[model samples]
Target: VLPHDPSMRPVWMMRIGLFLYDHLARREVLPASATVDLRHGEIGQPLKPRYSKGFAYSDGWVDDARLVVLNAVDARERGAEVLTRWRCADAQRAASGWQVTLQGPGGQERSVQAKVLVNAAGPWAAQFLREHAHIQDSKTLRLVKGSHIVVRKLFDHQTAYVLQSPDRRIIFVIPYEGEFTLIGTTDVEHNGPVGQARIAADEIAYLCEQASRYMRQTVTPADVVWSYSGVRPLLEDEAANPAAVTRDYQLELDTRAAPLLTVWGGKMTTFRKLAEEAADMLAAPLGGSRGAWTQDAFLPGGDLSGWIGTAQRPDGDFQRFEQALTLRHPELSEPMARRWARAYGSRVELLLRDGLGEVVAPGLYEAELRYLHEHEWARTADDVLWRR
Candidate 1:
């Protein structure tokens, strides 16, 4: 079992965002950077969690789903080939190692052998294991569907709300992509193909009903311009409600036949940590000398040295940066600059590599499009526009 840190509390994610926003408001511009230092082998420190109402919760980020895509892109950057439209056929243990077969778009077949096979398939981990690995007695992965809705902006404040629902779910009325209000998420049990996930009519009605209880403007289904669904693969527990299921992760090591590691129940914030642990478990059977490594490493485009706009530089530095970006990419408005600064931060350098030249692509640039395709395994333009 992994060690627990008592310094952490059962604080909701909204509270974390509120804390950041509260800190941001006092300054003229966002800090260019901040860093966290920690002591190794330290678990319990002190538990001090914020509890209140009407607090805004967000990273001031416009597109939250892009965070997931960024990590996938990072993985590809680290030399993992991302194949598209290929489905797994059979995976089992052989004398040499685990062999996995893949079926491509057509009736073609390909097989490969690996020292370890990781089940990072999200909601389909268990199902994938059942079909590929002949492991009957395995940990079950409970698929819980969470849905969100996008509505017309209701509040003038840029801050997002983390309001409490009567059913104990925390709903976010976040300021979306500078144009709409994003709110959601109902945790309902699901058992189906993860690719076919979508927000249901009832889920839409439920979200609107819940948000209407707090906001000045009453929300209805018709106001929703967009909606989405993601399946949280929770570790199966005896919890009565799907919401009560633990978000904590569990790793099952199958060295009984060969070294196969299956992971379930992890958050976007904790995925790097999860990957490290899974890699460590496979180290023994894979005969690797490699040790855990991702803790202190920065994810792609996250290595700005100061708070975003707080560098002790020339006057109007924030304005200068925004104006420079706008001049370079005319497609981006002032609000888009604001959005890009917060989301990409120092990583904006990666997107603006043309040195103030005319924008090669519309809305976003061709360099970014190529980067997302080459490094992040983005197969389509929609993945770039929507997910990125």
Candidate 2:
């Protein structure tokens, strides 16, 4: 955390939280937090001289879109039909189960009878219940738009900086795509449609101004190359501030007729646990097993066969895996090979099994595009560029 004007509560509170966190959990992957002299090292070099003292902490990052795609792939491999670009237009209680009308692209619709219905839509959970299922929900969703901006690389080091703004909020400046710095996120109240979320001009200026406070290099709105925003469906707790709203989720099961599970206000970090609990809740009603099978299971493309490092130290394993991937595909460029290995993990072999086909773009090839379309349900150019 960065140093601010007068109050040190944020820093001290962070230290105390880190202390409790280090003692509370089995921290085998990342190291514990510590006090650091930012003036002496690369971490401090990027910041202004006035901001000399700070705290350092560790956290892991994940490709969220890739994680969702991999989960779908794992489910499809386990005999679950994974459909993309499909929506539940209508859901009604049938004699045996739920009579759901699924609408697809080109205005085509299909009907399916599901024993149990799960409304796991992120921001549209309440809307789905009200509009499609014709059920009114008592709970409210406070839509908060979190915006982020990407700019040219700021610091040379790989360490991410968590800057405390004058408003007491924190923004992260992390390395992105090996060429840019990803900075974000503003939690502003959003009243527009969920899918229409876009980074506002003011949000961009705010991020740039906040980030420029500490960094030696001032961040300006002109420096931002790209920006995006997502509306968070947070559980409304009547908090006066949008940022103060709770992120925890609630699972509501309506067994009035057929079982309908409505998942409300959850972040991606606790998705697995939420899914497990949701499954367990519906297990008895659906006559399915109640075992927590996903607790020890690996997501698709997560297994590294020749891994030499434990869960605590997995960096070396991936480095070695990348090396092996490069060795196998000597014809591929080092950057391309490493990107594929990082993106697909051990499943890179499956991606390259058919051999690299025609070059579709500068770095993108036809084989990878085909694999994404066939396996990851990628259809549009935006899907390929932004998602897979």
Candidate 3:
């Protein structure tokens, strides 16, 4: 934890702090102005955690589109038809269930019949209800905006800083994309179209100013390499503060007329659990459920098992798995081997196909791009870079 005032060090924890430098390097004690000395002209202070040890950090970043694509792929592998680029024009009540009109790309319309209707359209769930009446529209969505800025690397160390601003909001300055620092997150009510969500100038300035107060180097708007904003679909709680709003999700099952399920406001962290609960709710009415099976199930491309180690230097069977991969392939490069260990896990053979096949870019291969296009639904350059 980074305290704004140097005197806060003694206030938070009296037992002198440890500034974690790396996996094997944790400098002990404090000489008062450690931030100024360690970070060189930074204006923040670090203190020892009340209960030391068990401090961890992850460098995991999910490609949002890839996550969706992979889930769909997994579903398809488990025998489910997935149709993308299809828009639900309307859903009319039918004798048995619902007659959903799906408009596909290149001017084609199809009908999909479902016994139960589930609205998981994120921020557009309520709007979808209004335009396409599947049930009595009573649910509301609280659109909260969250923005993040990627800038040139601020700190040399892997340990990220959680900065508390004067406004009482905390922002994170974490290493991003290897050569950049990712700083974020302002919670404000959003009114615009969710598709048009973008970082506001004030938000960028706020992030920059807040980060600059702690980082050794001063960061300005021009220093920002890229910025993005996402609208969080929160449940309408009538909360005065957007940040104060609940992140918990609410599932409404209206079985009066038919089985109409409305998914409102869910945190990504508990998505799997929420999904299992949702399945249980919908299943009992339809026929029956298999109960919660995902607890023991492994996601596609993720089957490796072992105890997790320190964040910086993770110790697991992953290393042995990679060694096995190298032994099997015999031609997979060091960096590609590591990438395979992370990205594909045990399913790397499906990716290597013939070989990592013709370098299209650093750490990216032509075969991978083709595979992404053929399987992962990557259509454009942005889809390949930003999505997949």
Candidate 4:
């Protein structure tokens, strides 16, 4: 789920929440809501809204929180070779020239002769070396489990709340998409594969209890619409509380056998920075052709000539730039169009390739699909539905 701020939450959560509040909210800012009711009715907090509902946009709008799909989509865009279900490196040394052993779509096999190689397989970073690279005594990475609970929207206001749980862990009541409030994030030690992770029932109860403090409504397991769990591969730190563990990333390089770089403790929001660093390290060994350049560069659709739209002051001087994109392109509704604008930034104009012409398609088109398919390696429809 997205967070209202990044002071405590992971960087990725902040990015998603910032994007949502920027384009979706009519007021352009999330207003704080005060609770008036805290009682739990017979069936507990009402399961569904009793009255009719209205929407700012149609159902199934894009920009939902689905990081897995978004990452896959981005990996494809950056021309990175991605393997879905891959095997361990097995501690074997890669041969000199570029080697390619095609197994199946489920696995990946490639050889690299770089001055540096990055191992960012989440929990499997240590295991990759233990099994494949013949590197003895690999550093430890303490795994942590973070879980979230999804429930019906808790407030009429468009803003999300970043509440402090009793345990001092933070929980967010974000306006997820349009229908539900996404809450969660409890960090505990993990001892299993990240893929096998699942949210525990107690975690749900804990989240509900914590949320009940700031909210007027009482949430429970029954009120939960959905839940998710993920494993964070954190740098081994002896901190007492998992919540207090450092969120910064660390890198280790071993030039003994071949160059082996292992990554630990990183989040989705910082992936861009991580990737650029990895590229710079690998470039020297792979033949340095380009210098480091990413911080200021815009992502796929983020290029803007000026900061979006401008407003005039009483004296006709420019004062502010509000989102009036819908005024120009009537094809997209305010929210969806704005989603494209913020997520893609100035790049939204590229989606309007025809330029001031009618929109031939409502949602996605063939050109877009082909671009994702060829450049982005989008194997499923969810990649576009969730990430694009």
Model 3, range 156-263, lDDT digits (tens) per residue? Answer: 556677666777677988877668989999998899898999899999999999877766578899999899999999888888989888899988887876577888
In terms of TM-score, which candidate is stronger, 1 or 2? 2
Cα RMSD for candidates in order: 9.9, 1.7, 6.8, 9.7
**Clash totals in order:** 8, 0, 0, 11
Report residue 374 deviation for candidate 4 (angstroms): 4.7
Q: What digit string (tens of lDDT, one per residue) describes model 4 on residues 1-388?
A: 2112223455455446555755675442233222222133222132222211111111212343433545554566778667654544444445542222334555656543434456777777777666655455546778889999999888655545556454556676667766788887888788877689899988998999877755657887899989988888887778888777778887665556556667777876677788777776666556765876766554454334364434223112111121545666676766566455545545455556644344325656564565555544567877666545
Model 2, 1-388: lDDT tens digits are: 4444345456667778779978887687778878888769788888888886787777778898899899999999999997788888999998899999999988899999999999988899889989999999898899999999999999777888988876878899998999999999999999989999999999999999988988899999999999999999999999998889999999999898999999999998899999999989999889978588887787887778644344434787788878878787897899898889878887877778889999998899988998898889999899998898
User: Native-vs-model 3 lDDT?
Assistant: 0.73
Name the 10 consecutive residues with the lowest summed lDDT in model 3: 46-55
Model 3 clashing residue pairs (backbone): none
The local distance difference test score of each candidate is: 0.67, 0.87, 0.73, 0.59
Candidate 2 — what's its lDDT?
Answer: 0.87
| TM-scores, each model vs. reference | 0.74, 0.96, 0.82, 0.67
The numbered model that scores best in lDDT is 2
Q: Candidate 4 at 241: error in angstroms?
A: 2.6
State how far residue 207 of model 2 sits from its true place (Å): 0.4
Q: Could you give the candidate ranking by lDDT, starting with the highest?
A: 2, 3, 1, 4
Candidate 4, TM-score vs. the true structure?
Answer: 0.67
